[model samples]
Target: MKFKDYLHFLSYAKSLEELWSAHTEQMANFGFDKLIYGCTRFRTATSLGDPEDFVILTNHSQDYVDGFLRNGLYFHAPMLKWALHHEGAASWRLIGQMMQNETLSAEERRVYEFNARLGVTVGFTVSFTSVSERSKGAISLCASSGQTQDEIDAIWDEHGQDLLLMNNIAHLKILSLPYTAPNRVLTKRQREALEWVGDGKTTQDIALLMGLTSATVEKHLRLAREALSVETTAQAVLKASLHNQMFVMEA
Candidate 1:
């Protein structure tokens, strides 16, 4: 598809699954047959947040993800370092550069060697613009098997601008979608209760509006707290809001 057509289709992605499929296909057209996109709002110096809370989408095999994401090997991934320190697009060749400079640790070298075995030797990383200090979003694109770095670089030289633009737009589009962690998903009633709490509604007021007893309203709030793993209603409200579950109109 043309660039403009792709942009139009991207804007209408209704769910994370649809967005991932569309993005994977688009990247494949550029010779990148494998893609992994991850984002987190809970990043800290010591943690990348709960894996359950991370928005991780990939087209790679389960074994690759198990070794990389599931097993926590991504922490030692060389490209991850580049993504953390840089904004915009960067070539995966940076991995070789760091290795050549003897800057890679043994664990980092192991991660690269593991990737090499799966033909993840050539690709590019795009670090998305973070809206908050604690948040980060990035994608790694891996060329198809047998496609060397030189060939991938040639494609980048010709279509780099277009690739960059598409990825940036996709990142922004994803941020606007409604999503919540699987383990933290609030039920419709729970979300509604939180929405009322976010709007400063008292339990009695919400009970009257929702046609439930104040005790039942309190029960819903309690369940919401449990689901979100928070200690209080206030924390539940804030956490629900962060997940785009509060104050959202039902479609």
Candidate 2:
């Protein structure tokens, strides 16, 4: 499809349902049988212990998806981990197994084989502007079998850039809407702390500048992470930057 058609279609994408509906047709046009775009809300790096972030899964067999969730497959899912920070588009050379070099683990192989047995192989994954370079949202398109890396790259080379741009626009527009979380607003100190981190300041440096202890600086950052509603210090910095909550310090 041409860029004009993409723009025309994207105008109708306000909510996840609308986005998925458009993608269903879009994927079919590109000749695929299954697709899914989902996110996980993590309170900490170790725990996906809460209700997962909003997930909009479609086009896959119900049994396939059910098995994925029941087995906790994501922990070893390489593409899922890669999407946490990298943006743009990419395709695995073969079944998700192609990543089996140093990039994957024994457990990752076990889980992937679980899917291979079910006939789902190879994938193309792209992110929709994550909350942090370490963590954010991702969308993935999977092929049942017999997909080439070149073909995948061709798809990305054709639509990947546009998809990235559109997802960014969609994310900003969503955050700007009235349904924003109440705790999004950070105290001046918290914002200051986070902003400094964004600027590459160390805890000790920020502490020296703010007349606080390294431990005290850590406290402010902890609060900042809570207010930002993201997990990980890296994600906090990224979120603050996304929301314009990151601060600037004078030379």
Candidate 3:
């Protein structure tokens, strides 16, 4: 593959949309059928109405997008969460095949089923957070229908960080956009926890409701802080509630 060609186009991006548009076209030329792009605002002030906002720029059927929104599929996606939090990518088919071979336990089986029905076949999940805050990072890119793991790994080895940086640039672009109201940026989990926190729930109280531990809740808060460029949870929450970009994120 002409991986170097993408590097050439990378130089022409004057804005976030240009960068993503270029990257999307580059990926298709690289043989991917679909490319999903969305930057997550880790925390938002509650004043922003509604939750998360996602804009799909792919040619994939509307059915795929509608199904994704109707069921709120992004929150429950293990691979998506993993890619966003970690620094690497994985094979959905390998994971799915693992389940088929019974390498995973019952819970794993359930996750695989969910992804399978969602029309996901094979893909690579990769992430980059320019700042220390993971939420302030860019959406992990998943290049689907990759014929082999070698190709997928090569994609990561070459452009993984570049793609991540592109997403980060997109974040900055998002911040520059004018809005009638302030934006609230928060992750799906943080948004949910914030609503509960407003209700006066303890971390433990929130954990049980969200099916996570207090530790995990804290991790989300920490990431949210990093993304929001704030020093404390209180500051993060306050900002999240006000930004128009700070989407409610269907938690």
Best by TM-score: 1
TM-score of each: 0.94, 0.58, 0.50
lDDT of 3 by residue, 5-46 (tens): 545555544444666566666666544556565444443433
RMSD score of candidate 2 (Å): 9.8
Candidates' lDDT values, in order?
0.87, 0.62, 0.55
lDDT of 1 by residue, 87-182 (tens): 988888888898889988999999989998877889899998888877899999999888888899999999999999999988888877777877
Candidate 2 local Cα displacement, residue 54, angstroms: 3.4
Query: What value does the lDDT take at residue 74 in candidate 1?
Result: 93
Cα shift from native, residue 117, model 2 (Å): 1.9
Predicted structure with the largest lDDT when compared to the true one: 1
Candidate 3, residue 227: the lDDT equals 65
Query: In model 1, where is the ten-residue run with the lowest total lDDT?
Result: 242-251
